[model samples]
Target chain A: MWAITRLLAGKDLRVEMRSRVIINQVVPFAALMMVMFAFALDSDTVLARVAPGLVWLAAMFSLLVIVQRSFALEAADGALDALRVAGANAGGIFLGKALALAAQLAVLEVILLGAALVLYNSHIVGSGIALLVGTYFTATAGLAFVGTLYGGLAVGAKGRETLLPLLMLPVVAPVLIGATRATEAALGTNGATATDGWPWVGLLTLFAVVFGVGGTLSFGSLIDE
Target chain B: MNPLINMDTRATSTRFTSALGLATLIGLGWLAVFGLFLSPNDRVQKTGVRILYIHVPSAWLAYLAFVVTGLASAGYLWKRTRSLTLDRIAGASAEVGVLFMGITLVSGSLWGKISWGTYWTWDSRLTTTAFLFVTYIGYLAVRDLGGSHEQRARRSGVLALLALVEVPLVHFSVRWWRPLHQQESVAKGKLSDLMLFTLFVGLVSFTLLYVWLVMHRQRVAALDDMVDDGGLDRALADRRSEGMP
Candidate 1:
């Protein structure tokens, strides 16, 4: 188990550094999202109203693209078949895939944070920065737990790109609402408090536990089909 | 690619059809007819409340279909039997789920226009049903994502498991938060003996239709598999000799 974990994690990180595939896909999308949101706002004042939602919504959309690439890379050239033959448990595979997703999403959020700060003149580097960054990870951890599973499912289908958002959007509603509300509160005119960040954390923790464990146990069987 | 081929001669599926499919078809017809005729109109809303006949049943069956999809998904992941029957069952349920959910939404909106003076309420039941409908559409969409049969089955099982989380959330969202939809405590509130009988008949009949359609769909899927296996040309040739279309 330990060997498999290391192998899976090492592989993703190695390829990520070599190809920089995640950053290549993610940075441009986050930049474009901020530019689009900037155009949508009629005035600087209205930016505050929609800022939190746009930040996370954009982050979520970018994360979807990263998740797709993460699996797509594995599926090419028998890389996934190699992982399976390496004696990796389904649990290890799930854990590694989710970790790769988490890594990719964390980077995406960083780019988004930079854009939000510049575009909206939102304050950073204090409680708000901590809250926004923390909740972003929690909520997205929950999102990636399931996203990798479905990303795998979509491996060979026609129209996979079109099909993914249709499947993912409704299921991601909780993350959408929770992340939006949490980030909004953190960056709000209101001062930061644990109250703003903790509940979102708690709910997301529950989500991660249920789906994370379920995916671990079931991951092996899914690929066999 | 011949779209329609006769499946009656297929020998592998005969045993499975007898258990649940036939009994339900008879029940659906009886209930739908009786409920349409016998139930009295609501006192406050008058005849507009009659739309509940479609709304409630469609809502019920929609949920039932998703539940079946989840179970089939679980079964596929666990047993790895590659049971085409299970995938076919999951597909039918998702299709029916979307269909019924649509009826519930449309009929509910019509009821709302008269009852609430607005065409839409975002009411609790209506909101949940709409969200649930979207979820199933996602289910169907995800099942088509990967190119190969193996890819479709694996990915769909994963998506099904993930989406099932929303089922509980949608059902309980009303209690968890305030919403525009209403609370449904009973099947239209302590239905009288006749109403109860009608409701039973309705549930049974709808369930029957669900089964019959599923059977026919499976047969079609099986024939498609055969054609993909190089049987289509042969079957079409056989049919041409008999001068069938």
Candidate 2:
């Protein structure tokens, strides 16, 4: 299972590397969203105060694009059906796709943090830096698991472009709430101590575990033809 | 008459369903009188407290409805219990649940206006309820996505299960994000006896109404599936006849 997972994850990453869709399209889109937030908020104080939330919001929207692209790759050329016929383990497929999504999102988030720091002029306190990284890791994992699962669910359907977001966004509300709060605590912008961020990270970790196990167990039944 | 096709065009009603509807109507009327005219005003909230009769019960029933939906979806997914009926039940319950959830939110908003001096607040309970409402709405959308019945069942069953698991996570995250709301008055036995009784009446009536609606909705869903299947069969038959001629 681990071998299959590695192989599929490597395939997705290599495909992504060759295509450069995440680097070329999704990254700019996420950065543009951060810039747009700066424009909409306009005030430096307000922008700095809410930078954590803006960053996660940008990440969440980018998640939709990345998940759609991941599943769309499989759907475009009957790759999913071929995998099924080849008797590939469904759990491995789910984990591999989710792993690839998390990797891409990790990179996107690093860039988003830079954008927040530069554009929003947000400063992360020394103690909170570790909390901020923890939030990114756990929250990204949670979002990837959910995004991949719902992407597969909506992939073959008509109007899937609209359907995927509708199906996915509500479920990921926890990640948005948790990640934003943890990030805020890390930035020390809202009178929250760095210790306050750990509990939210715990929530994110719980979410990741629940969906990660749940997604692996159920992905076969969901995407089965 | 083909056994494969049901020709009945009448509404899916039965004697038991009629009895259930009648009981719901009577219960609703009783609740309205008691909740509005009979129950005493709270010293603090006064007339605004009356909305609790509708708001609290609607919220409870909405949760109940979603629970029913989750169970029905589980039944459909389990091979030993798999059936289109369970899928229909899940779909029906979710539809009714959304309606009740909408009522809960609107009423809660009104209550908030009276109590919190705003039409909306980012309170934990309010946020979680809103998220649950949207989640179920998305679940219903997935059900409407075109697919074979089995495909619909499998996809939505997995979704329902996943969404159900996320509810607690969403609740806790929101609660921690901002915890502000009066502690639940009912659980604390803070209400007067008459108010409590009226609230009880509200709960019973709303539950009955949920049952009546879900029963009718499930039957309608079964009929809808039959019509869809029958239409495809008729189309195939027509094509075959055209080729023969």
Candidate 3:
């Protein structure tokens, strides 16, 4: 299982490294989201106050793109069939794809954090940065697990590009709420507590476990022709 | 006449449905009369509280519909008794669920405007209901993706179950996030007897209305399946005559 997961993750990482689509396309899109938010709000104080949420919104939008690409990559040349015929375990395949997506999102989110700090004239200093990282990991895990599952389900379905986000965004509301509130607490805004972030962390973790395991066990059924 | 197309059964069922629809109409009419005229207004809420009769029952029916959808989906997924009927029931219930969810949101918005002084709020119940609305709308959309009956049934049954899991999670998450909505006490000691009676009338009538809608929709689905199967059979026969294996 470990070997298959690594092999699949390595395959995706190699494709991402060569293409740099995440760098050239998605990162800039996330950055543009910050710039647009700043322009729309048109107040430095308000922008600063809302930067945490803006960062999360950017991550989620980028997530839609990444998950779409993940499934699309397989569906293109029947690579999904190729993987199945290669005797890859469904659970390993799910975990590998989720890990690969999470890795890409982690990089995108780190860049967005910098963009949020610089573009919104906000700063994160202290042990609070650790909380921010924690929130990012858990939130991304939940999103990747869920997004990958739904992406696979939506693949080959009609109008999947439009369908995936409609299916995904509402389901991930708790993550958005948790991640935003956690980020706000980390930034010492909204009179929020570091303790306030824990339940959100727990929720994100639960989402990750439920969807992650559920997606793994169900992937075989989803991929059945 | 074909047994499946028996005029007597069809006519009787249609008549029964109309009779049930009329009763529902009368039940709802009396509910409005009771809610609007007979039930006394709250000292604090006054007439604005009238929205509660519609809003609460709609939310209740939405939850009830989704729960039925979940159970029907479970039946569809289980191999022992797997049937198209289960799938059809699930889809029908989800459709009714989405309709009621929409009503819940719209009425809640109006209620909030009258009482909370805003058209919307991030209040926990409101937020969760909105999520429920969108999720089932997605469910209904996925049903239209047009696969083989088995594939569509399997995929949608899985999605229905997954979405069901979110109902409780959304409820808890929102409750923890913001305790803004009023606590659930309508069935408790909160309301006066007349108000409680009116509310019960609303609940019972709306539930019957949901059953009527689901049954009618399920029959429509069955007819649709018959038509779809006939089309496929004709297509296959045409292909066979053309020597296309």
Which prediction has the highest lDDT against the true structure?
2
Answer with 2 or 3, whichever has the higher lDDT: 2
Off by over 4 Å in 3: A85-87, A191-193, B1-23, B185-188, B235-245
Q: Please state the Cα-based DockQ of model 2 relative to the true two-chain complex.
A: 0.84
Tens-digit lDDT string for candidate 3 (A68-107): 8888888898888788898888788888888999999999
lDDT per residue (tens digit) for residues A119-170 in model 2: 9888899999899989989999999999989998887778889988888888
Give interface RMSD (Å), model 1. 3.1
Per-model lDDT:
0.70, 0.90, 0.85
Candidate achieving higher TM-score, 1 or 3: 3
* Candidates arranged by lDDT, highest first: 2, 3, 1
Tens-digit per-residue lDDT, A91-177, candidate 1: 788788888787777777777867777888776435666677668778778778878766765654567677777766666666666
The model with the greatest TM-score is: 2
Model 2, range B1-245, lDDT digits (tens) per residue? Answer: 44444456477889999999999999999999999999998898989999999999999999999999999999999899999999999999999999999999999999999987998988778888998999999999989997788989898898889888988887887777677766888789899999999999999999999999999999998878877888878677657768794
DockQ class, candidate 1: acceptable
**lDDT tens digits by residue: candidate 3, B160-241:** 9899777677878888878777667674687899988999899988998998899899888877776576666656665776
Model 2 regions more than 4 Å off: B3-6, B236-245
